[model samples]
Structure formats: C-alpha cells, structure tokens
Target: MSDQLFGSWMDKRDSNWVVFAYFDWIYSSGMFIQMLECLSKRWGFGTDDVDCRFPDNNSFDVDDHFSGVEFSYGLMYDPDVVIVSDEEFGRYLDMACFKYIERTPGSAEYVRSMLSRNEPGNG
Candidate 1:
C-alpha cells in the first residue's frame, strides 16, 4: 500500500496464531500476488494467502483496527501439522513484514500509532 504493509509486534512471541496487520492504501494486485507466492514458500505453503496474525496479549484480544491475516485452510482453532507453537507465527510475520514493509520492520510504534487514533470520542 503506502510503501508499508506490516504486522506490528513488540516480541515474536507476543502473538502466536495472529497477525496484527498495519497497512497503507496502494493496493497492487500484481505485487500482492507475487508476494503471496514468494511468502508461501517461506511459510510452508505451496500456494495460498499468508494472512498471518499475532495476538497483542495472552488474553487473545482481537484488535479492532485490523482483522489481521486470513488462513486458506480456515481459522486456527488448534495448532496442527501446519503450525506448532513457538517461533512459527513470529517467523512468518517477520518474513512478511520484511518482504512487504522493510528490513527488520514492525514494532510497537506501529501498533501504538493505531491505538492513538482509536480515541474515546473518535469513531
């Protein structure tokens, strides 16, 4: 999008089974498709959208700002052969951010940036 499509996180382990997507408008179908192909291989997917996610906290509170990534197989109700706990999602999210956003990008600043906009009076 705006040269920045990211998933924010303080730590890799901050969210397993979630991708806290932070993006900017500038959708390019070609770029998006290509990214999926490249990212899929890295994420153990032969062909599918890697809409990963990271829970901001242990409470598993879903952020209202973004819906995060969607899985091709379906929502992750239980970890399976596709994904085991530990380092699975963090690595994927990191890979996506690196490829789409920037090298070593993604941090609390991105998340906080959204929180600031989610004001009490501002719809």
Candidate 2:
C-alpha cells in the first residue's frame, strides 16, 4: 500500500508496473525501465522522432512525440514525468507500458498493431 502510493517499487524490484486500469498484472519485478521505454515509444503520435527534456528535476526525459509535443501540451514544455495527458493517449500508453512488462513485448505489440488496423477509425 505504501509502496504503491509512494513509488518505492522503483528502488527495489518489489512490485509490477501497473499503471491505471488498462492491464493485467505484469510479472514486472520492477520493470520500470521498460515502462519508460514503452511510454516514450507509444505516446499516441510517434513519428519515429525523439527529443530531450531538461526539467528542474535532475531527471532526463525522452519520447517519440517530438513532432507535435508542443501542440499536444499547448506549450513547449517537456515534462519529466507526464502526469498530465489526455484520455486516449493515457489509455493507449498505459496498455503499451503494461505489455512491455510482460515477457513478450514484440509479439504483444504485433497483436496491438493488427488490432489497430481493424479498429473503426483506421479504415
């Protein structure tokens, strides 16, 4: 309970990375590094681009949303941790993060890609 509330799972491989209500329990053992990679990869509008953030905190941020990050955020701010995101982006990113924590990132992503092609709006 305290670990969940305070993100102590980051220090030790104590808990799985379950972000919000978008997934099943991942066998993470603190797969937090994979979470950051997944978030940066599937950030709703990936154009295979990249950017760096120099936030006040000493944490460095990177993501593929470099093409329209300013437009997405309404400012030129690259948040170290994206605590604010619109609903669709947040949900999809969470899904990817969860998948990355599993043992089969590539296969899971392939499934998602196929599903996306069949989703209503894509056609």
Candidate 3:
C-alpha cells in the first residue's frame, strides 16, 4: 500500500483524490468486483459510478497471459469538515481491505498509512 503500490496511478482532481489499484493476472475478476462493491458501500455511491474493464481474447496480449483488473475511486470527503474527518476516511480504507478484500492482518494498516501520507500537502 505504499505510493509505489499504485505507482503512477494516483492523482488529485478538484479537491478529490483519485486512487487506482490494479491486480494482475493472478487475481480473479471476482476480486475486482468485490472491491467495487466495497467502494460503493463505503462511499454510498452505486457501482454505476465505477468503471471496470478487463482484457479479452480480442485485446492485446501480454507476456503474463493474465487479464489485469483496475479499480479506481475518487475520495471526495473533506477531512477538515465536521461531517467527515481524516480518521473516517482512513477507517473506510481499512474496513474495505479487511472486510471486503479479506486481506491479511496489517494490510489495512499499510493502506491507511499510505493514504495518510498521500493526502494533499501531506507528502
């Protein structure tokens, strides 16, 4: 969950943090779908807002022979506002990784830490 985990896929736009997490061929499409579901639930937005695409037979082939999955979400919560605090945003990422992704222990912590560091002006 370090900045390197996302590499060049992280950006900011209009006061929103756009984060992209990609899974290589080793992971299933179901995993990506589950991540979308988790994000929808956390943001109170529908999956319709998410855009997911996977490689197909007609798509260009790579050496890995694995179709990658990309999950992107825009974090629009204002941490300085009373409605949403920085801790809440961090907790959302933690819960998404823990409950939805079912990642191992400490995984959520790593995500939270990285996200905290990536916040605007935090770098």
* Candidate topping TM-score: 1
Please list the residue runs of candidate 1 whose C-alpha ends up more than 4 Å from where it truly belongs after superposition.
Answer: 1-71, 74-81, 103-123
**lDDT tens digits, residue span 1-123, model 2:** 221222332332322221221122112234334334443443232121222121223325453233322212112345112223334444544454455535455656654554454334553
Q: What does the lDDT come to for candidate 3?
A: 0.35
What TM-score goes with each of the models? 0.24, 0.22, 0.24
Winner of 1 and 2 under lDDT: 1
Q: Count of backbone clashes for each model? A: 6, 0, 0
Model 3 spans with C-alpha error above 4 angstroms: 1-83, 103-122
Best by lDDT: 3
Q: Which ranges of candidate 2 are over 4 A from the true structure?
A: 1-48, 51-85, 104-123
Ranking by TM-score: 1, 3, 2
Error in Å for residue 106 of model 2: 17
Enumerate residue pairs that collide in model 3: none
RMSD of each: 12.7, 13.7, 15.5
The 0-to-1 C-alpha lDDT of every candidate, in the order given, reads 0.34, 0.34, 0.35
